[model samples]
Target: MNKPLIAGLLTLALAGCASSQPDQPFSLTVAHINDTHSHFDPSDVQLTLNNKTVYTRVGGHPRLLSYANQLHQQAAQTEQPFLLLHAGDAWQGSGYFKLNEGAMNVDLLNQLPLDAMVLGNHEFDLNNQRLSDFIDGVTFPIVAANLDVSQDSDLQAVENLTPYVLYAFKGDKKKRVNSVEDAGKYPVVAIMGLVLEDMANIAPNIGQAQFKQELVSAQQTVDTLTEQGVKHIIALTHLGLDKDQQLAEQVNGIDVIVGGHSHSLLGDFSQLGWEKNAPYAQQFTNPDGLGISCVVQAGKFAQAMGELTVNFTLDGQVTDCKGTNTLLVDKVFYNDVRRADKHRLTDTEQERITGFLAKQPNVALVDEDPGLRTYIDETYRPELLQTYGAVIGHVPSSLQHVRVPVANQGSQVAPLVAASQLYWANTPEVRGVSGREVDFALVAAGAVRNNIEAGELKAGHVGLDILPFVNAVSLVSLTGREVAGLLLETINGAIGDDTHAGQFPYVSGLRYTFNETRRGHGYLANIEYLHQGEWQRIIPDARYQVVLTGYHASGNDGWHTLFEAQQAETDRIDLAYVQDELTAFLVSRLSKNEQGAIEVHYQKQALDCQLPGVSCNADAQAFIDYVQARRPILTALPESGVTVNRLH
Candidate 1:
């Protein structure tokens, strides 16, 4: 054979071998968002640098949509096979959900071209009927393989809900095939859904719906999909990041996982201008040591969109993957202003320019997407603005609602919430018995979502941020020893190593010193409580009634002792809705005078000190009075009472 002929034949032979290989690589792109929490309107978010609040105003739904659309368009231009997924929690958090019963969220979310979304715990917040209605309204599939909805007729009838879905992607149609039989070659992608197994414990509206263990459900799904000749499989999970990571390691065939629930922001930290964490596409070796699975989660509140480009072998194994959890910056306005400046500038344009210039001295001005801006203004802004303007009360100074143990003390907001709960628990109308008082009140740090900013506090702010959950305030009786044990357990389980724990105890009439360096039960020291107007060390056997949210009283968040104590009718007293109770408490304080002019008296007392200066009254009046008198200054409890001996 001639040299040219030999070379051509060799090339043809190599191509034929490559086509026959099962390990051939194919690429697919996944764009996802999670835990939006009904925050449709753009709100001010404090941007932090090195754990310091650098500036505010970072995200909005409009900008998020614009960024997602841009990514979709780019994928289309590149002719890349892509899928858009929402990992869940599309309900609750904002006033929009409360106003429209998640109708607005469903409507707005329907506008996005999503392939699928896993059911989040919050989806059950409105009960099965509404959840079924919301599911019916959506155009895309709502998948959750582990949810046993047979008991719920409405949920069982949801036509769009499924266990898993398969998406087929045909290879390049333009590529010439020598044989007609070989023309339809392509890869099939299968995605399975798993919800948090503890849904019923967190969202009671789930009722009889049961959730299977994530590992079991995921493994079974993967096995089924694999047996059906599907090589590439993904778990569209609503399990938080920690569970997702565990799932990745435990499951055999899960090629990738898009997760939510923990509201984790995964990816290159430096690019997002936030704390460092796992890369957007975090890889984990399968338990069998045969393959690798990747996991990604977009942060909550439309703050970022996770973009993952994954390549898989023909046999359905992940070969390569890359991408990031892209932050949706409000840079679109810069161009808008530039374009407007070239023409006759309108009043809005002038105002935008002025605001942009003002941020220039310390922070950079990033513009939001005009399309999202218009949507918020025309569709969502009217009611939201009214709520924002409806002033509930005035705060003399900013009450800092930091979640971390600032100076070894818990959040100021937590105590305020606890005090409110305690006040309601003592009221005959709320307590149901005349002249009854809870011995102490406890509020979880996570329950208090946002801080009361120094200024006019509005009803909308409270509804949208402060008291977002609809949990009822409940009272439970426990022995002083049990109470002390519950506190110790909370610190050990939830507040491990002195890191920020949402379950961290914030009390109205309890004081305890926490040793950060100590392990297990030893973390707590010098536990004390106010009894009969005196600071007294807790008597181990003394029975004391405690006021807290029903969620907490049920022994959720590692409080099994409290749960055991709340089983008795005499021990447990369920009060009114927590939001309504808190609102009534604030209203009561505000109505002290015709002008609603009331002073909040929050004494700067140490966490370990005996009810210092009589300011440890543990009532709404104390918080109200403190706010009325302390103008402009952020309230910090005196550090003397609760001291931290170890390095944080």
Candidate 2:
């Protein structure tokens, strides 16, 4: 796009420069996906078709691969440049990640023909070593200009890592490889990466690697890229949609942003009965008003992909842009995908839905990539089944996990998880050694990964589906004032920005009202604690033991107060892993009443139940025991109840 530079290169051949004619518009088709997690199988989605509410399965890696391959083949036939870019977050969420870690992800992702990918925060969940191994397995280059991994011992050896990728479009035939950028000839475009700088604050065990500020890194990278004669730029970012927009408005040279994080679906899905206000390939005018940057993101959990087509002028300006963010569906239909009896959709209904989907360009009914499907079915699928296929508890209703609760819609699972932690802490064995009872249990919303549906639950459902991170439990002693500080710190940290709301705390045996209008410590009021058969206000000077994940105890993910409270060695107690505590809590749920109904009595006062001679192994087995013990599982909040108020 640097016309003066291009004009001076009279010896340059225009073979791969979009088109042979000068001043012609260059068309680029970018099929992008972000926050895919590791769901290998199809995810069930309910839709209204032919005036009937019906269910069908959509997305998965195989389906995504199938559809993306088609797009690439079509682009090649048409002689247009096409790129499949992943914005980040390709780890965690399912049993595949739990059993195989990054190994399976590496193998499966190696099958996909992606040109480049960005590093997501979740990629650091295991450690720098695991991330390095994953990096070594993949064929695509990771474009992350903002992150400095030189300090991490394992990541230093990664060879494919780069600040950006340059595509010369056949202009430099001799220097075909991307790493050695043609210094003289102008490349068609440069794709770079920018992610959250405070990644260590959010993800656990990121090692010594550090990330630079998103906006600053982007501008610097763009400036550097432009200096090298690559005027057209695409920022492959993992900073979510809001930050992506901020980058576009602030950075002048970036012409496109394919982003992840925030898990936002951008595009019109109104034809499918929802989302008219969403932005798909939305273009924002640059700060200088000289050009525009187009942005797009796909939803989470391998559910969908965003396909964006942009026509760029010779000066790196977006002339026209269009795209779709849609779920790639298969033909299979079910009444309840989670339950044992799927209640397959009638043939007539499937036909009707198929006919309806055929009319919508924003959606696709696709098949799985045969190679990927065969590998998953034969290798990882059986391994997952062996580890996590047993049926656990049966949920009576759906419990959604909303990061920042809004009007009558708060997390129904976080409190349950908190209660589980309390039960695990109060177990006779654990409490006897510590000689202290846990007064309250608190959990961060970010830790709860998924929702619980009203159907059959599997062992892996909690271990892999919900709480996938291997964070250990921590028992910490803090004064009432300090406890309040931790709560407020998390509240304000996540307030207004849902992106950081993973730090928002959900508690058991505690209640408080948060008035957003107040300043400093005044935002929260009516702080109360559950005493013996009473709801009492917490004494400011009193010391109480609290249960929390080690991540939060160490003050990760905006829980600054928790970090400060545990400065001394005596201030903290390391218990079992959080997965262990949750699994044990499920076992405690087996406490029954004389009336033969499952007693819901795992509160502060109630005894943490244990089998006379049986010990439920942490993570999956305990959940299985509880589920098998109590059919059609039911749960309610604490007696005085958990209260979360945001009066803004």
Candidate 3:
């Protein structure tokens, strides 16, 4: 738990010239990005500057490449060893990947000058065959030392995919370039991939692949490389930042760890109105207590790059690790893009905002690489346009998502997402399979993605933006006590620390209050189920059918209680893909586009003005109710049931 050394300008170089002794520290710049998630094009970001919230686009693969190329050139000119690495999850979450799958990710990621990349859990989303094709397709090495792919022949046959890669920066550049050469002439850095050890639950379609324990694999790899005369070692990992810290604390001889999968943005973004976040390029003490291991990860969705200059002693201990988590953004700014407002920011305002931004070293105004942008627009975007062009639904306001939210509302979208699962489960076709009506639905906070703006929600947006993972909805039978336990654990995970917050639960037809000061199951209180327009307290022994995704059912993320409940039961039925249900929920239940509710007078004869204090939000009240059995009024957003009384 030592204070991490980062967010600084490096002022010193190697103790003189590069030498083979512990006296002269080896200084190298390691540039990294993680959880890119197929964002080849820029995405919208809202920033606050000079007391105004301005909308601007930020972070694309093209822009990321453009910056990395510049860094690479700068390092080359100085003869400093520079390595650009991706810590996995370059697939899913965009239309490009939806249509092309791993094919598109391979094509675009291959374009980057990536030295090494680990395998993220999403890489196994399409099973081993497709993942094998992607690995073979990529030009760079795919490193995952702990992944046992020997049982799967297709993955086993991939040439460039290996446990670790050795880089001989001081060796002859022209000799056996991609692999090692002249090993005796210079010390080398061994970069190995260490992925999440559990495979069955996270990626069920993993197909004959098994992952060894992360710490064991890391220690073994470090030992093997050390025996081979390698002084420097880096573990390119898909484990989240918390896990990375754990790895740093548990192991010895690892100089650095580049990590992904948590979608965590480190460093300060107070200038952009973002609350304080985790520190970037944090350092942890190795198990030996004498060595320093620096752990760094770039923010998710290619939004930023992590640049760490590690000064390592000849014995492989890090002397200094200093760097910045730079946010990549465009120069354009606006008041709001949702209303298609173009001229909201005046010239004076723009100048003032620009002046404020110029002072922050972490914020950079840059342009995309022209070639990559053109390819994205011409080759990939048109197909996505054809696939997801039509508008399916309209929103009243922007629904923001936070994996761990504060105050009364846990998340704006996760509850809605859970409601969708419940709706999909009760569909006649699915209910027939289950042989019973589902009582409620559940979704992990991680399962919901994207801050849906107040505008048209398109057909393509459902799969490509939110709920991008491939998971099927299932009906699981659980006692009320079991349900309470499941929710408490997920809340505790989110509240405990900076790790595994993605497991926070959002449920439909149920309400619960959380107290931060309490311990174990006592953290939750007033647990109730919405039954026939009444909130009834849950009975401990009563059986209820819960609808959720296969991932939750498998005990992935932090929903281990559900997995244990499943293990004890025999009556569980899988209904449909979670995204399909989410899409239906938006279109059928939430949208007001089809036959306006005011026009149809759907809510009530008195214009549905029931709550005395609150005015009827027009857009909220005016949603289409085309489906039968839609009993309760659609627009009345249920008062937030999950209230946080004492969260820090």
Candidate 4:
């Protein structure tokens, strides 16, 4: 906070009080929501309200509608104006959207009285025709300052859609009715919307639309809205939290930014003051640098609603801000003092949303012809069961499990995938590529997200529960030197002892050694790439192929070396490549077998032999101990070879 500017505002306020002596304060309420992503169903989310543990079931459209009505009523009682604004991504996700092409959620959203809503990345999941159809169903305006929807025929159907919406609310304080000539007071509020630029990159095939820099688009909208004689400006932003903060800092005319995408629960107010010409070409308009702004996000899955209260003087300058971004619970009766039971939902509430599909339109379409929802649900279930042979693996309850804490190194999950890759490679289809059965598969361990159960576990049970993220695989060719370089980078990024061979790439056909003490810079002094049970020093320019997830290939979390290596190969693979080729290859092999099962076994090589002079060592027994003790960890990996066999 700039103390000098605040002091100046205080002085101005005191001088105004001394002159006019204004008696009343004016306030209005803005209720906001974002990243709902079609999770209209209520969620059991925990919150700390007034320093008390409040278990509130939040965010169902019906529940939200009911709460909005209640809040509107309260506002009416207090003679204050209330506006409901949705930040973005009110569509997509869940079985509901997949089943109905997002029309069901659009219908429900239309029922609510909203001032305006912004477009999010997921809104473009379907083509423009479907998006336009959904928008046609909505009663209120949808704005996107950045997206050029004009080029699309379907999007152009919504003629009334504006880049920014200007709302006029009656300000507090009764006007004198002298001589029947006095007019009623009215306060105009302006709202604008903007989408992030990265939508083109992330949601590429969904829509061929592009978004401009968030700050630039917002500035343009501000100029337009301000020129129309509206002073108070609120921005409905779909650009995530970080971008929202940058907007707050870079954009001058914006008063508050209701952001989405990243999914945050923000209650604290953020203030930014103008210091002459701020960075990013922003020119200050507010006098005395007293301008205050805030940015908030109400997580994903419609789990929360954000409400804000701002007070402005008759002169159109905001003087104060109060209240909070309260996340209203769906179950209203739970907080009722008169209720005998603490739980709000009657048995009827539980079943209420479950049968909502019956009343929803296009339900028959999804039921008859399921889309992505059906494919994903069907694909994962059967495939998970076939990957790991054992129906269940039991472990002690006390064993603790977790995701790989390190970024580049192999995790329990990476090794399992590496093992599966090796096992799958020996199949006929892949064997043809190398003209050899196969030797091993190497995987970095950092890809794992969660831990497995400590107790008895099943094959489908573990893989399904553990590796839930939908990531595509990419296969790349590299030389022996490149592999060694990649291994060096991987080892250097590891957290624990690197001398333990098991700690390196979870390998099926490869073995390597590293000196823990010497494994800092130039750590990987030497490595042996194993093929068909024979170890050989890698040739610098020799072409070697390896498979990894698209995320790793893209190097999103900063595996630049891996990304560069993949780029060097120029063999970029789509997600469908692995799903269809490698997965199918494994399935075909498993189906022909009598038992239809694949076994994953691990054996640790002693580091003393590989590391030579280095004393660092972990024997086969030690590795077995690590796997058994960390069964929860070992099970976290994605198991391969689940198949759907047609019964003859």
Candidate 5:
């Protein structure tokens, strides 16, 4: 890890050397924004200055550009060198960025005087080459220590980019009486980038061109910069707060690590000091040799800006520092260009969003319904309509519990998901295009987020509760023997062998059965695989195409065998895509049946068991209680601290 020192020593050499002046004390400002996601509309801004009633639009290139300019002016007046930095995940998310493929945000970012940019996982969603192209259009140097972009076609030139950068400012020097007054090089502000290894696991498809490991790569970057005498080190890290804390523990000499990814709005800017004498030196409140390492991450979006002032000396060392994380709000008036009459709601959404922002509480009094404007703008605002593809159906009943499958039909959970996958794979235009039809689909009952409700929820709520997190459908190629092995593992892990074998699939396209004591795995006796309409023995070496969400494929919830055996590769279909497909399938089913109900049924198997001295029910209940009580560790969140129920 102690590598990459060769390039850190030299960054810039001026053509003309001015005589070195007396060492003077000066201030420098390091400012940054994260997760803007192209909400450039004036409506996104909010302000809460003390007793100042202001209803101003927020979060667009124009507004941000203006704020940046103001900061630059303030820096000049205060004799502090100012530097602008972005932590990461800046290019994707909102309507505008999606519509124009990040052009608007890119244009806006370049318009501001940004010194450096850090690469986030989302930036790779367009694939490595396009990501490189996007980076090329930016004026600042992009820094990421763990991303190996050398192999990418568009980013090869930028691979050799130093993980840390030093910016030096030349300013007038304050002199003591009779002391030689000397102009000083700009305060050297050091920038470094770090990303979590799991970032690859979570955003696999987008991050295929890169690899991430936070601690090791970050330490190397820091050591190199510290050796080069960079005064203040700022980590523009996209690895989230916990990972940032871990980095602070393991590495030393870094002054500040600005973080992102986990959007936490802590409400203020504060410093965390690692203790010098604590057993875990890294997490200590104060470290013996190192000055406190200040870590800050403003909540996501342009919701806030983090400002830190580091006081240092002529020899490149920090003396003392204090600052605040400021919440930026609109303080002026803008015209309402969001009227639906101006253009089609969808067509003018992105532009209109700027005009529709809600008047934040305690800020100003421009409009009462600030949220409505945000909603309208977001739904229609993005220049592109790419977010519409993914939709999923919701069922009211909890699907977690199992029951008997219908005489002629199969498990409802199985079939419903199967139908969705089939629909996703073979649409009117996509059927048999690549000689691959999702022959089989698999979903663990545990993967279902919750019972879909009968009534509708907010679009965001549905996305959050049903889909929860982002996951794509991964197509994995597996042999029948491998499939059988997976099934055997499942059976062994289940309550008992008497439980049905097909139960594990929680899917409808295929079926199989097993007996507990009568047969070994029941594969030799009742094992059967169904496809189309007939029975087929799952050939061990015969390759079968299977579909599963990306989470399982990545072994997120204990699916290591599937990951290893099936050779899973995410097909790049996010959960939103599955949600959309489900919605379409439900609609189609509703139209065909006319009843408008998508019902899924599962067969509950009755297992025969004997406890030497206890009733089966009582024995099972006791055992459950024992296990629940003895569980080594638990982390469960309760809705409330107290509960009340009517007694019968």
Candidate 6:
């Protein structure tokens, strides 16, 4: 949407204004949210005191809307222009996204007065056709400067999709500020969008849609905007916070960046009892040393809304930047006390506590908008419950699926998940079709989002928590050397010195000992494979069949060796979803006459020690054996299945 009249008028003002003239201050509020991940209903956020869980219920979309609307109204009253920006990924995650394929998210988003939105990588999860349809229905502009959709006619035709859009911020009317007549009064803001450069690897179904590097594309867009006399430029980015920072440091002519992905929390985290970062509006010096750019991101899942107030000079350089990342709390949250400590709060005491919280100044608590609440409760909640409420299976004990390293124990759910994938891949039906057996299976730690809680597991749990994305399992061939190298790289690069990493590989039909204290590839040693009932050291030249999700198969997470492997055969098994496959494997272990209880336990095996103050071993063997046995009866989990060693 280019405006020739506005461009011409702005150019004339720029030419006439003297360089020696005093810099005039122009202020505007940028209210932004990112990576909502479809938590339409109020989800529980644990409130902890001194590392102990105290309260649970906290954020949701309704509360986000209320807080954002309040900010908008305040800006209007003060005669200050404000822009509401959403930095993508409004699709996937919750039951609502699964039920409506992002329609519900779009509906709710339509209700909000959004200025612009960017395309997140997850937006392509539904494939090109559905994405086009979703784009067609949107009211505001969906801009992405780096996306190259030239080969896809359908995507090119989507009306709402664009590379960039210009926003003209006329001075506040209440302040008696004139519009076009006062040439230098208003500022023209150019907002450009940039998605992650690795969209092709992230979502393969986004056919022919390529992405340019964020730094290059952002600079090009900024240069063009500046050439057009647009001084105020904001990069609406789906690039994660780290990349956004890099962009700010490298790119010139950009005044601000609103970002998503990586789900980073960037603000005063202490108010929420969380770790803090560099304020809500963090400024980065430009590489050219000309000016600084402000970068901000609202935490994911609508938990917090970011408010950035930027004051720019008449020449478009940022004079001052300040704002808050307010955590949204509901009124009920005020009354939520520790369950064990409830006896300490008498009726009168509870009332006084609630009153005290209600009266606290600067504590943001916004009541859910009635219309939005009704829309969710009456229209969407019932459908979500009906579809995802069916019982799928049962968990005998709480599965500890958190991603962390214990002093001497590894991941809890990762090994089990990898074993499940291997079990399904080796079935007669699957093996016969490909005429090849799976030597091992691998899963990225990030694939498992939430732990399977103890008690009755529902279909919704499988859909939303277990396998949130529609990733398929695929079979690929790699040499034993490549496999070993993959593991080494994973531990060295993914895990490294970090206590927990999403790229950590969980495997089946294979075992290895990793010395955390050792440097580089030497950290991994004593690699072995179970071949024909015997554990033998892997031969560097031997080729082995492997099963993994399409995400890893494409070399997304530093697994380029697998991606470069010989294409001997590729099969996309038409089994149920990954979660369903996991359910099937668990269900098959139950006998008709017996109740089902999937047991899980951890054990450790000593192989060898290499580095100082560290032992090397394989702990996944018990988990591998448990799945391989397919026991019809399991009253309780084994005492020791896999032991993890946490490196300090």
Residues 353-443 of candidate 5: C-alpha lDDT, one tens digit per residue:
3343232211111222244345435654542334333222222222322222222232333344444554554444334332356666666
In the predicted model 3, the residue pairs found to clash are none
lDDT of 6 by residue, 1-648 (tens): 111122354455554543332346678789899988887866544443334333434457878777777876687678686788999999877778877887887788877777789999889988788888888777778989999888886697777888888765544321111122233444556678999887876764787787888888889888876665667888999989899899989998889999999677776455345666766678999999988899999877787788888998777789879887766765543223322344244566445444644553324666887878888999899987886665544444345554434553555666666776677677675565445688877887777775554334455665466656545455666777888778766666655453336667766777777666643334554777778988788889987777777566656666655544533332322222221222111111111124532121112222112434331111122222333356222123332122234343
Put down candidate 1 lDDT per residue, 1-648, tens digits, no spaces.
000111343335334443222346778899898998887765443333333232233455766666666766687678676788999999987767877888887778876777789999889888888998898998778889998888877887778888887765533112222222232244557778999887766675986688988889888988887766667788999889999999989888888899999888875455224467776788999999989999999888876778898987666678887887766544322221112334334567546544643443212234556765777688877987775555545443345565546556556677667765665566656445423578778777777776564334555666456766556455566788888788777766654553336766777677777776644334666777777878788889988878887567667665666655543323354433232222222101101246633222112311221322222122333233333334223344443233334444
lDDT tens per residue, model 4, 119-148: 888888778777778777777778778777
TM-score of 4: 0.54
What are the Cα lDDT values of the candidates?
Answer: 0.65, 0.71, 0.71, 0.51, 0.48, 0.65
Instruction: State TM-scores per candidate.
Output: 0.68, 0.76, 0.73, 0.54, 0.51, 0.68
| Per-candidate clashes, comma-separated | 13, 0, 0, 9, 49, 11
- Model 3 clashes, total count: 0
Better candidate number, 2 or 4, judged by TM-score? 2
Query: Per-residue CA lDDT of candidate 2, range 44-155, in tens?
Result: 5556565565556678889988987788668656766677889999998777888888998888787777878999988988888889888887888898999888988988
Instruction: Give the runs in model 1 whose Cα sits over 4 Å from its true position.
Output: 1-24, 48-54, 170-184, 268-273, 332-369, 388-412, 416-457, 468-504, 508-510, 514-524, 528-648
Error of 6 at 576 (Å): 8.4
lDDT of 2 at 384: 85
lDDT of 3 at 8: 21
- Give the root-mean-square deviation of each candidate in angstroms: 12.2, 9.1, 11.7, 16.9, 17.6, 11.9
Once model 4 is optimally superposed onto the true structure by TM-score, how far is the C-alpha of residue 57 displaced, in angstroms? 5.3
Q: Which structure is stronger by lDDT: 3 or 4?
A: 3
Alpha-carbon deviation at 550 in model 2, angstroms? 8.5
Q: Report the alpha-carbon TM-score of model 5 versus the true structure.
A: 0.51
Model 3, 1-648: lDDT tens digits are 011121122112221224342334577789999999888887666687757777777789899988888787687678677788999999877778879988988878877888889999989888788998899888778999998878887677778789998765541121112222333344467789999987665765788788999999999998887776677789999999889999999988899998998877888888787747788888899988898888888888798988988887756668889998888888767765443656457788877877888789888777899988888898888998887666656554456677665656557666666766677566675555556788887788887766664445565676567766646455667898998888888888876644577888877888888788843323775799888889899999999888777567657777777655644333555433232222111101111236532111112222222434323221111111111135221122465456767633
Better of 3 and 5 by TM-score: 3
How many steric overlaps does candidate 5 have? 49
